[model samples]
Target: MAENMFLFWGSGSIPCWKPMIVLEEKGFGGYKNKFITFSNKEHKGEDVLKLNPRGQVPTFKDGDIVVNESNAICEYLECTYKDKGTQLIPTDKAKRARVLQRMHEAAANMQQKLVLDLLYYFFQTKEEDRKEEEVAKKVEAAIEELDRWEAYLGETKAFVAGPDFSMADVWFYPIIAQSIRMGLDLGKFPNMKAYYDKVTARPSVQKSWPPHWKEEPPMISPFKGRI
Candidate 1:
């Protein structure tokens, strides 16, 4: 049953990493995959477009079923492979709610601010057209998002949702890493820094760590050293 799974993924993308970590956690580490290069715009190709209309990586398949969004793929894998490996979505009602909240929060709140407003804004906007006031606010917005997580982790103690490592950690880990890679200083957020360090050492995360990141991370981030 597990053998039919396939993933189209690009290195260093948070969206791509979410499902890859889920696959590894579900003990499907050797599942078939094709590395789609973002630089080459391979994700926009016809093959990926067939499965995902937006032509995104982390276009995941399990036999006849296709799950395109990263969070959706993680949920599908958890619901399908509940017994194959770690149980990510806890059965407890209260815990399950918290897990779900954090999972989506990583995307809705965290990614929106960090990727879209901050880094993507920095990269996409032309230098001459850049306005110092708007850029400063975006940077601060990213910092405020981190402040939210820092406080959340401080309360949760071990992982994003609770003490147990669950689907929430699977969702949040990559975004946290992306923040750091973009030159967001972790020194100001102790709790988030601890969470980052702890998740960094997890086998599921380590084994699926983006290949390009290991070889060469960008020396310069779009942050312009502000983060």
Candidate 2:
């Protein structure tokens, strides 16, 4: 296996955490991690920008090759280092399709609502200036998405895709953690709540959790009691 694989990533970014979790699951060898600071704009510097024109964290470089998108980085590692780590996408043909289907579904149907429609309200608007009705509307939409995932997990049991901990879980766990940290009531979705507990307990997830999240207090959810 090749070494000197560099990953530039920012703490607390769910997208960045995907590859961090993937690297950890891949035994943390053949790679060097370079943590970036969002506050300092390190991700916007020439080095990262050269690798990722978008200047985003989770920009990965393997020798001369560069992979920017988080899910794509995970897929790259899974494909390139297939024999080096645990099989993330699964080998069975039918199961592989199911896993990949749910992976994209979780990103499109769940992550978009949770991050963009819901959390962005808090990030972009001050609490004092926020309109209660608008926040409630976004919360309602995000909950609908969560409900769909909760139902899926309730049926899947062991992981997001199925019995194995595959790429779907790798993609889904970080945002779910952020959702809870931002104060979404895990109890509202019993299956997801339990799944959160199980996944976070894993060595890779625990290790890859945002460093700042451990040192600083969790962020308060904008939808506190309304949702």
Clashing pairs in 1: none
Per-residue C-alpha lDDT of model 2 across residues 45-131, encoded as one tens digit per residue: 998999889999889888888899998999999988877667898878999998899899888877888887788878988879888
TM-score of each model, in listed order: 0.94, 0.94
lDDT of each: 0.86, 0.85
lDDT of 2: 0.85
Candidate 2 least-lDDT 10 residues: 218-227
Model 1: how far residue 26 lies from native, Å: 0.8
Query: lDDT tens string, model 1, 65-154?
Result: 898988788888899888888899999999999999998898788889888887787678787878889988888888788888889899
Task: Please give me the total number of clashing residue pairs in predicted model 2.
Answer: 0
lDDT of 1 at 194: 86
lDDT of 2 at 8: 89
Best by lDDT: 1
lDDT of 2 at 207: 82
